[model samples]
Target: MKDFGKDLDEELSSLDAPPLGDLVGEAVRQGRRVRRRRAVGAVVGSALAVAGTALLLGGPLRPHSGGAGPSAVVAADVPSPSPVVRQPVTGAALLAAVAGVVPDGLRTGGYAAQTDGVNGAQVTGAQVYLTGPAGTGMIRVFVTSGESEASCFTTESCRRDDRGQQVVVDHMKGNCVQDVVVTSRHHDGTVVQVNVATCLAWTEAEGNKPTAPALTEQQAIALAGDPALSVWMTAEEGLRAKAAYPDLPRIL
Candidate 1:
């Protein structure tokens, strides 16, 4: 699991923001940025592709909606697995949140917890909040478009989460749009995330190995589909990520 996390982190970082900023990874200073959807939530990733991405037009994607849940992406860049929960969490209690999800040994040292406002009100209208437990500090996860709703990605945080990965919910969306995230927590303590606000959803998990927690290139791109989250992505500028980075193959 640890090996997978490292690989996936690398992939998400290549595309999303940076390894530390991408999916599951060691704590960084949190100064990374990626563009996707419309809003700019947490800027991070492992292997996010560039150049002519695999996105639809500005309008709707006419994507298939599976009644069961959303799509999942496995990152090929992941090489390690370590469970770290996001901070300033909602709905579920901490600790109990990711209880049965992380691998026993991975959580041996116990979980590190922390929380912080993304920018402390640097941008107007929208408040970006970056929270989550790192080895010792906290990593930002979600962004609140309005004052009312906020969404985050928890990789199998069963304690704090009532819903599993790939499932969408009307949790905090103002009207009924729904705040959603793409999680990759197997029933066996491997957790990852690639959350979305509106259009599409994706997860960050290792692709080939069964131990990493990074998303494949595709998953990284899809994770960036939040209508609001995309605003800060490199894709926002119309750069070609797809044309540049090819879709990573699935080996595991």
Candidate 2:
């Protein structure tokens, strides 16, 4: 689980807001898991409830036994879900870049819509955790799920669609699912939303050295296992992430 925004969080945490620190720590942990399993599933536990896992930004660590995975959302016993990761995208480009490494003959799945919501607002980037066969490349792609113009302040409809959208179907066969959604308060007293999922988070010490483009295995494990991680929100970072992605809601 290589966090792309740890340093900024560290600088922010120097002030106060212990909760934000916890969230950050969890993020760090998730980053580690991604590295260890390459953002895929290495070990399968029991089924995890969609509402059970959320996001975190903390020290590197391992994923707690988050159960297996959610029960398959059979498409009314129909043919199956549609093929996601359509062409014309870099993420698609990247998947094509690594598809040669995936030797399962076929593997596909993606969000319900093209956009997704976090906390109470819509966001572009989504956290996707996948599980692959041993020796098969582990995959994780945070892409646009879909836009949500409907269901704003409530979680009923949004929650169902949210959970369903987070799941990816590989080769028409599903093996991955989203975990949970949690709301956090930033150091400045702002509320932010973060999501989490099951993955073999790599730690800093064992995965890679903390640097500009990577994190180690030890660090990843610490972050995943520890809930004290997932700290708070970075108004600056959020603003930047949102600004960079204009389509995404600024609700964070």
Candidate 3:
């Protein structure tokens, strides 16, 4: 026991031991290697995660098959809406339509007033005068309701048009006079009458003798067959006609 501690110390000193700086440097290098390996593993794992996320999506990150960048898609052209076309109404519009379809060589003079009754029923209609090489005459259009129950004609011959509308022609015969009456009953129970009356005498003093009407039977029939004339039978247009011609009577 007298020299045991000293002997132990001497023995420990005699044994070879690593320096503090060397141990510290070796530990630092080992630590750097371990950190590098960990960093590499983390970068690899992050890359795999990014690839998996791209596949989970619709693969928008995937390269194009053409090897070029994605192409822009163009949208189709849309057609513009067409303009609306409105039908003609009102007394002036109706008169215009009649004037347009009138036979050639006949010029519209001006609107006039003509009185006529159908089936003993008094109905007021619009009137227009026509002047042409043939002669000067008048065209009258009458719109009346309850025409379905009325007789086709009292003294004149009647026929059906291609549209199945009842057509009546009245030819008033007199020396130097041509008076033609063309009447029709539409399917909607509206009656239209076009009367063309002409006299050779330009003045009343010349004589009351009649002359050829400015229009023919076929032309008169065509004017009466125009669909624009039917607008007066409608309630909306009837009111307008009444407003324009306050004396116009209601046939319905």
Error of 2 at 193 (Å): 13
After superposition, the stretches of candidate 3 with alpha carbons farther than 4 Å from their true spots are 1-94, 114-122, 148-155, 174-178, 200-211, 231-252
lDDT minimum window of 10 residues, candidate 1: 121-130
Q: Can you write out model 3's per-residue Cα lDDT over 100-219, one digit (the tens) per residue?
A: 678777777646332333234333345566787866665555443334333433444678777777776655443122256566667755556665656432233553334456677887
What lDDT does each candidate get? 0.25, 0.26, 0.44
**Per-residue lDDT of 245 in model 2:** 38
TM-scores, all candidates, are: 0.20, 0.19, 0.46
Candidate 2, residues 120-230: lDDT per residue as tens digits? Answer: 322222222223442111223232212212222322212222212211111101111122323322222222223333322244564432212111222222222222212
Predicted candidate 1 versus true structure: per-residue lDDT over 39-110, tens digit per residue: 223322222222122233243234344443335332333333433322222211222223222223333221
Candidate scoring better on TM-score of 1 and 2: 1
Best by lDDT: 3
Please list the Cα RMSD from the true structure of every candidate, rounded to 1 decimal place. 23.3, 22.6, 51.2
Native-referenced Cα lDDT, model 1: 0.25
Candidate numbers, best lDDT first, in rank order: 3, 2, 1
In angstroms, give how far residue 70 of model 1 lies from its true place: 54
